[model samples]
Target: MPALRNIRMLTRYTAWANERLFSALGELPAGEPLAARATGSGNMVRTLNHAYVVDRIWQAHLQGQPHGFTSRNTEDTPTLDALRIDQARIDAWYIEYADALTAEGHDEVVVFQFVDGGAGAMTRGDMLLHVVNHKTFHRGYVADMIYQVPARPPSMDLPVFLRDTVPRLT
Candidate 1:
């Protein structure tokens, strides 16, 4: 029960952070330095694109739709506006899915093929946690990329999300 509660909190916090990041991304001028290759392997735009693609892949899995990403090396970057729109839509889905979930839902196991075409199954809870953790990891990379840019990067931390958006909860 505590784990479920924790997951619920994390899911909420992730939604909050996603909104903030997407909003900040919208403010970025086009053609601005997206990422610092010296600091990380992928540029800011590329890392964000990766996150977006992964989100879509997992979302497709969750929705029982056909997934779009087949390889990790594939390059996919829609315009910033397009990515921002999709991010907002997916974040909303995550929030709604988290809210509507019951304990029984978390226990249900879903089978799916990985991006690499490997077959696997995971509990709804594990998959949900994976989505949150996956976003957090890549968001950190995006934040790092933003730091290398001329514009100030938004605070994407969970604590920051709590303090800034859900102050009443704490």
Candidate 2:
């Protein structure tokens, strides 16, 4: 039960951090020098787009819908405003999905093929954890890109989220 609660908490943090960062990204001036790297390697916008694609793929998998992202190199970039809107919608869906999950649901084994055409299976919980970790890893990449910009980068660290947003936890 504690582990389940912990997963839920992690899910919440993921959604919250995503919303905060995406909102900041939306506020960034379009066509500005800082925004030029939106599509560049290790860029915030690219990393965020990658996360969005992965999230959509996983959501499809979870919902038994046709999976997208057949190849890892698939490049797609929307306008900042469009990306933010899509991110919010997907984040909300993930939040709902996480909240509705039960221990039994976590234990459910899912068999699915990878984007690379490899078949595999994993517990729903493991896949969910992967989703969270994957996003966190790319978020760090985005933060690094932000550091390259002249302006100050937002504090996106999980501890920062915990301290500032969920202070009562300690």
Q: Candidate 1's residue-wise lDDT over 41-146, tens digit each?
A: 3566566667767777877777778886676534555666777777778877877887777898878888888988998888888888998998889888666666
lDDT of each: 0.74, 0.73
Candidate 1 lDDT trough over 10 residues, lowest sum: 32-41
Pairs with backbone N, CA or C atoms under 3 Å apart (clashes), candidate 2: none
Q: How accurate is candidate 2 locally (lDDT)?
A: 0.73
Off by over 4 Å in 2: 32-42, 167-170
Worst ten in a row by lDDT for model 2: 31-40
Overall local distance difference test of candidate 1: 0.74
Model 1 CA deviation exceeding 4 Å by range = 33-41, 72-76, 167-170
- lDDT score, residue 97, model 2? 82
Cα lDDT for residue 102, candidate 2: 92
lDDT of 2 by residue, 102-169 (tens): 99988889888788888878887777788888888877766655656644556767788778777494
